[model samples]
Target: MKYLFNLPDFPDSSFVMQITFWTGKQILFKNDALVEQSGEKGKPFLIPDGNGKVVKAYPKPSLPDFAPILIINGEKHRIVAKLPWYQLVLALLPLLLLYGGALGGGAGAIAAMLNMQVFRNEDSAAVKYFKVIGITVAAFAVYFLLVTAIYSVIA
Candidate 1:
């Protein structure tokens, strides 16, 4: 997906970055023009801005806080869409609840993926929160069903 970032010294909405979630490939663009591209996931790309200045961009794929950052003249710029606090808490509920043990961890992983996708989207606040709640309920229901089936089999 393409993420747009506003650099400190640059014009409004000048930086554009694309990061492949699964592959980790990162592409950087300035004002709709391709500046630098990298095939390796999570690898940093250096782009020469202007007047012999260089900008270092990093594609970070860490869970719950997956945001790419650009280092322009020693300052860091985040390239991520912001979500509301309530929505953020709701999205993280599943991962917080079912985070331990093998079966629970599986459910947590699924929920985390869903939450991550929800946060990554550029949708409206209401839609994002709805997705978070919907995904959380769905993950819990699936976890319950799996546990029931396993218990029934053992008994």
Candidate 2:
């Protein structure tokens, strides 16, 4: 989603991370370029106070405790880039391809199993994203069954 915000810690008094339609959807990083949920997420949200500090000249809001201040312009904003179902489909796509390949040839199944390594919520961002999707638990079920079935058949 396009965002016009700023990080909390900055050298200059005024620094903003402005995003527009041309820039496309971008994620604002708090402390670094890559924002991993596990890492310490400094204040990185925006709230338009429209008061003294906020009204005067874009007071470069400090990142709020919560991240990703969505819908700032008073106009309802739809999530442009978030797709929880799509992630599940994407993660499962490769496996589906592997399943097809393995079904065709046992080697493909083995290769798929080897490649599709399911970890236990190692990536905090992934966990959070999945949790937001409301399909993490269900996704795990399908993932377990699919992987185990493939392995059971091949091994």
Candidate 1 off by > 4 Å: 23-25, 33-42, 59-64, 119-122, 153-155
lDDT for each residue of candidate 2 in 1-155, tens digit (9 for 90 to 100): 22333423332333223343333233444333433222224333432232433211111222211112333323322222233554434333333334444343333332222222222123676664544333333444555677789899999
Cand. 1 Cα-lDDT: 0.68
Q: What is the alpha-carbon lDDT of model 2 when measured against the actual structure?
A: 0.35
> lDDT tens digits, residues 40-113, model 1?
56456666666687556665543455555665456666777555676566767787545546777678666866
The whole-model lDDT of each prediction reads: 0.68, 0.35
Clashing pairs in 2: 43-63, 44-63, 45-64
**TM-score attained by model 1:** 0.70
